[model samples]
Target: MTDSTKYLQALEEFILLGKSAPGAAAVANIQKCISSPNCFVFAELLELPNVQALVNDAEHKKWVEALKLFAYGSYMDYKQQKSAASDSLPDLTDLQLTKLKQLSLITIASTEPHRLTYPSLQSLLDIPTTRLLEDLIISAVYASLLDAKLDTANQRVEVSSTAGRDVAPGDISNMIAALEGWSASCSSVLTEIEAQIASIQASAVAQRKEQLAYEKLVEEKRKTAEKDGSKGKRVMDHSDNTGFGLGEDEMDLDDGPFDDQGGARKSRKGGNKMFSRKR
Candidate 1:
């Protein structure tokens, strides 16, 4: 429903299609998407570890534009001249030139030595299936990193696209091994992060419990003080009523006569009588 969700869905569909599509169609599709401005802008701002992973036929063109704009600057025309002079094949064909161009776009953006590596792109210019596959993997990994979605454990350090396309058992084994290696790396990093979070949570819980205990002890002390104060007040009131040393004039008793014979006193107003006894 949301724009972001729509884009994400589109991206997922595109990825699925890319995986199943023939290599030539996949490259074309990815190139077309990369050429669009929206995809280009998104790739630029993405913070993932491998930015190249997300590019389809559409997104790769955007990256090319970025390379052209910021990396190329005013020396765009000179790139071919430089490449021709450095490259072994001065008479490289049109197809080779196109491949060189693509490689130039990528190498300029990459950390590898551009002058030395552009020739390889030149070498693979005509092949629609194999070279493109290598580029696709490279692009996917790069994009994933740039988009903040790249898992290092999923990285294939020695991924070579030239392996036979028939899907042999050995190929499957190699693929599984590479993927397992990548997953292990990712799992280790994830575990470390989880451990740190758990430690912090435990520390916070302990601190809170200690604080509660301290507060409870303070409350108990306050209650005890109040009880002691009340009891002392009661004792003082009792001592005052006994008239141990104070004169009777200081007392608030009503006018009443006590016989020397110590006879009982009764209320004359009603049958119910209220009385106090002196020590």
Candidate 2:
């Protein structure tokens, strides 16, 4: 069910067929494999003993080349060869052509993850119209060759994912380099995430310290205020209990009320008693 093996059963049939096929029969088998709607991966099929034998056969060597084109070459590769030597390679079936273009799309998307503009694909695949290109893209999506959106507004194909095609011997190095670049990008992203988390944690710690320090300052001020209030209360208590803060001109409570003559009231009472006695 994996992308690499999605068409594996169909390919296995070709392998089995090639076992009994001989001479030109092998070339026919290759043709069937390439033209099969379900078959996409061809490295295994190409390596079969019966199929490889076509390379030595003068009459069928071109069929082997045609198969190679399906396995790894793009649609542009076919066009170039057909243009240079019209009969050098076997003519591709419509289905075969469509499949090759789909595989080529995978190659292009892998190299450039974005920027699948309609114009670029049309130029590369020699597709004549927007409708044909869109149909091909939609077919590729349904075939599970790629996961992409048709950005009609943007006039582009936004590829989110793609299946791998058979890697030619020369393509191995490019694949490795791409993997290395991806690993480095992932490492950089991880480092950035770690730095952001550290910054957030450090900020949280600093804020906590500030909050604690502010609370400590408030507690200290409260204790000092209470202590100062206690000292003032003690001073007032001392002034009330021992007359320590009294002024010299302040009256004493022990003296009696004064009379109109500026004599003590006790003297007025005594004069009233004397007058009463005289009466």
What does candidate 1's lDDT look like per residue over 52-80, in tens digits? 44344353434333323222221233354
Per-residue lDDT of 39 in model 1 = 30
Candidate 1, which segments miss by more than 4 Å at Cα? 1-99, 107-180, 234-279
Say what the RMSD of model 2 is. Answer: 5.7
Q: Over 4 Å off in model 2, which ranges?
A: 1-5, 20-22, 105-138, 146-161, 234-264, 267-279
Query: Per-residue lDDT for 1-279 in model 2, tens only?
Result: 675666887799898988899888898888888888788889888888888888887789889888888888888888999899987888787888888898889888987655489998998998999999999999889889899999899898988889877889997998899899999999999999999999999999999999999999999999999999988874344276656776654545335465455554544223432112221
Q: Once model 2 is optimally superposed onto the true structure by TM-score, how far is the C-alpha of residue 238 displaced, in angstroms?
A: 14
Quantify all predictions' global Cα lDDT against the true fold: 0.43, 0.83
Q: What is the lDDT of residue 77 in candidate 1?
A: 36
lDDT for position 108 in model 1: 32
Lowest lDDT 10-mer window, candidate 2?
A: 270-279
